[model samples]
Target: MTPHSVTLDLGGRTALVTGAASGIGRACALRLAAAGAKVRAVDRDAEGLAALERAAPDAVETVRLDLTDLAAAEQAAAGVDVLVNNAGLQVVRPLEEFPPDAFRLVLTVMLEAPFRLIRGALPHMYGQEWGRVVNISSVHGLRASAYKAAYVAAKHGLEGLSKVTALEGAAHGVTSNCVSPAYVRTPLVERQIADQARLHGIPEERVVTDVMLTDSAVKRMVEPEEVAEAVAYLCAPQSSVITGSSLPLDGGWTAH
Candidate 1:
């Protein structure tokens, strides 16, 4: 894909970004704030949230939230003009060995929480006739892989939820879409490298080139900032006509 810079003016928007403490979420929170939005950064990491607050005290406010608390997750989204469901977790294990509890937790935080957040934000968005919902899905949402049943399942569910939200919200000027990316340079992917290495019986270095990037034509990991830019673009007026779509930052993984 050709690279292009996005210019946006969100002077009066209030944006809520979950998993805002680090990685893609951090980049997104800062990017939106730079565009003049009042951002509420939510995450379960207190120290990370504090660090994020210090980085942009005037533009960002931090909220420590564990999405497993479904009620609170919904309550936290109230009155926001933008909602980014970017918080998620993963476990690598064969289905037979996978813990049932882990599967439920993954679905709860990644899928159910997003539903509640949308539910909470919808009323306000409908009232104003404008809102943006960006779900951070993964390439796994479209394609399955070994040892990632739960993560893949949750992402697939998120994709469906996003599409449904788009269909229903279009009439109200509230758009919902997903940013599905391949492996990103994040703490989560870093952790996955080791797990993948062990599971595939390869060295950590080989996991990147042989396992992770095996299908990626670019042969490199995507940057968190790149994913954040896509999120920002979806919120731009230029993207008002785009909804119920999945934009893949897969470096040709999906192209194949």
Candidate 2:
């Protein structure tokens, strides 16, 4: 964690953060709540939501709803001043062997759900003439990996969606951008390590150093708080001019 945080003052704003049960989403909910925004922490995990609310008992409102429920997801996003599309799951398999059902679920949660949430948030945002949409994209959004077919595809689609929202919402004082990070030190990625190990027939430690951090000049995994900090920066007053762009926290993976 950084010794000093870049404080963002978001008084009177209602921010709805998806995937708030853990990892990057949890950090964002906490950071925004600390910034004085009324945070609606949404996640499918009821117990995780409870834990998150306990962390900021007065500042965060917990909403437990699966994003796969498109209508419910849209309804949950209504009237939110800031929308953080951060909920995602990954399935690793080669193209011919990837389960169609899992692929469908991944896209539904990662891509279509963001579309519905953004749709629901737009009327309020356009009416108020001020809003922020921060999509928690991945480095896979920019670059592809072998067994992560579904994940890469969903993130790439999300990148396109974010840019389109930026273009359409530009005139209405709404800014939509993506914060793309490389391997984060989250359980999801830890599970991914196991998946990659099995796929490559390698040990778990070898998967981490050789596969996960191969392209990253900085070999260490990124912390969730770092990604959240970038999200907070994009929501600050200084970020009004940074629409339709991607902020990469990939430890210089793209430098190659």
Question: How many pairs collide in each candidate, listed in order?
Answer: 0, 0
RMSD of 1: 1.9
Q: After best superposition, candidate 1 residue 183: deviation in angstroms?
A: 0.5
TM-score, cand. 2 vs. native:
0.98
- Over the stretch 137-168, how does candidate 2's per-residue lDDT look in tens digits? 99999999998888999999999999999999
Residue pairs with backbone overlap in model 1: none
Report the C-alpha lDDT of model 1 over 106-153, residue by residue, as the tens digit. Answer: 999999999999999999999999999999999998888899999999
Which portions of model 1 miss their true places by more than 4 Å? Answer: 1-4
Please report, in order, the local distance difference test score of every candidate based on alpha carbons. Answer: 0.95, 0.95
Global lDDT for candidate 2?
0.95
